[model samples]
Target: NRLLLDLETDLFATCCYVDVDMEEGSAWYVRAGHLPPVLRHPDGRTEVPESEPGPPLGVIRQTDFPMSPLRLQPGTILALTTDGLVESVEVDIEDGLNRLAAGLAGSDPSHLGLVADELLTEANRSDDVALLLMRFDGMDVLPSRESWTVWRVPEAVRHARRYTRRALRSWGVADHTDAALLIVSELVTNALVHTDGQVRLDLTLIHRRLRIAVADNSPRTPIKPTNIGWEATGGRGILLVEAMSDTWGTVPVSGGKQVWSELSLD
Candidate 1:
């Protein structure tokens, strides 16, 4: 709102702004008398956001532009361009837009820089041609990440360790692999060994701290069984976790319990 007021009074120009909410992987944007941006999702989905546009900036002293919101999933692509790119004496803007969308669809999603260059090739010389391409790397997906996967008993044990190790290494927390692999293996093992229903492992990494969490549909909390003698098999995993990890704990969650541990990167 404050931004809209400023745009109305401060300057005379056609522009757009996207304010991204990192946690939600969504954006709030205002298109004040500018061409709408083209959005392409990883699934080959393409769209142009629809919102009522206010007059160009400075057209009215106290203008109010409605800000629209949209999801920005990981691997999503956004292409913003000036009107000059589509406006040509020889071509209709509609034709230009169709061409642009087709070009974006055909271009390699992995190499969007090259796609942008190819787009500029079709630009008109009658006015300024400007383009900006953005690809989203959502915090919950990659760069900073999280994952949910079910575990089924003995088979899941190996998979859980492998997944945790690979995910940590992908996060560039190689130092954590030795400790995290052991910790996650323990947690996943406990979840499967004791639980009856669904078992899941959720992994998250943030700011050099790696959190390994396992949730399972068991009402019971983890504890060393008195009858199981402390040997190679008796609750040694938890003991190893306590000694090797920076911190560890358990909490009650809906229909189950969640055990989590945090490892320090530095």
Candidate 2:
């Protein structure tokens, strides 16, 4: 939305955004004046999801894009496309959409590339045509996650450390408990001191890697201090988190951002 406003032009665009969570076997999607996505179930069934959509981009300021959630089973295929493939002067869009769904139901999902080619062969190309298809096979080994809401009290940092220690021990990764606790403390303290709204600490164990994530209702990314004097007592939380973990990064989420650190148990 902010991106469209920055353009400052009369031209607007439609969009369909999707976010998939493999661990949870679910996805969230929002359509901005775009066609509903088509889904093919594992049993060779097809249907278009019915979800409300927001206005086209650059047409509304501060518009709320409502998201719809879809639970994905193994072997489910999701298809997104532009209206050019389903709308033409001679054909109604509803009929065209039904034809597209029927085509998907008959195609083989094992060969996605071939399926895409076959679908495009029948498209009405008077305008631009685009297609995106994804098969959700799901994760073979799901990660174990534990989350704790950090209160805005003085004992928040200590409580976060204790939670991390317990989770690490339960996951049989207690050997790295000290480092994990330090990372959690630094991250939780940073979020509590610097950000606003509810703060959460999440510990995830997948295979032999452990991921420590701190999420808060703020979009600001953590800044790494370039220099630190010997007498400096603060602004070292990010540095400590970086040094303690193999990799650390931040990603934007629905309402805010999540800062995460990953350590390899190997």
Candidate 3:
């Protein structure tokens, strides 16, 4: 609706959204009259995944945009760009796409900026251009696992804080120890207090973020408290987590709901 409103205001816009599945080695994409995504394989072969483009936004009303599938192989680099990156009034869109592919095909995948620079040079860029690159590293490595605990009520909160501290240390993210431990404590406390069964605390450390999840047996959701009172005991727990966490949310799984929070490493 918001996009349609922008189009109604006479702002011509086109976009391409791609959701990559690293594990499955595929991506589901939507091309809204923008350039189709290009996949550069390991063997220096670049190809654009077939996609039907819709009319540019603001040109048509009540348009239906279709999704397309893009399969990714190991060591493949996916390039998504706005038309300016590959198209101009003077150059044919297909030729521009070929130029982008050729530029990326021979370039090293690690340094993506060079590929973009080369493509821009070939394009003789006159308009604004936005380029996004994704290189899918092979999924051959073993997954990492961490220890977690299950407990009920107040006991778990203390245990969670201690466990969180140790986990942060082991992950070499000791800098976030204080804040992350505090955030984990609050989330675990909420799970224990609200649900019946034992609260399961899970922590996973990714490349960019540290994720902490507290799962309980009850389906009830944790409310984000607006009014916080550090002095007045209780009820400001979720608010504290929200303040400390980079991002937080609740997910309802098979047995119950899990309240999770993430803290960025950088």
Best by lDDT: 2
**TM-score of candidate 3 against the unseen true structure:** 0.63
Cα lDDT tens digits, model 2, 165-229, are 88888888899988898899899988998888999998889989999999999999999999999
Clashing pairs in 1: none
Off-target runs (Cα >4 Å) in candidate 3 are 6-8, 58-61, 140-210, 213-235, 242-260, 263-266
Clashing pairs in 2: none
**Of candidates 3 and 1, the better by TM-score:** 3
- Which residue ranges in model 2 land beyond 4 Å of their true spot? 1-8, 21-24, 61-69, 88-92, 121-127, 229-231
Clashes of each: 0, 0, 0
Superposed Cα deviation of residue 51, candidate 3 (Å) = 1.2
TM-score of each: 0.50, 0.83, 0.63
Q: Which runs of model 1 end up more than 4 angstroms from their true locations? A: 1-11, 140-205, 209-266
Q: Cα deviation in Å at residue 160, candidate 3?
A: 13
* Higher-lDDT candidate of 1 and 2: 2
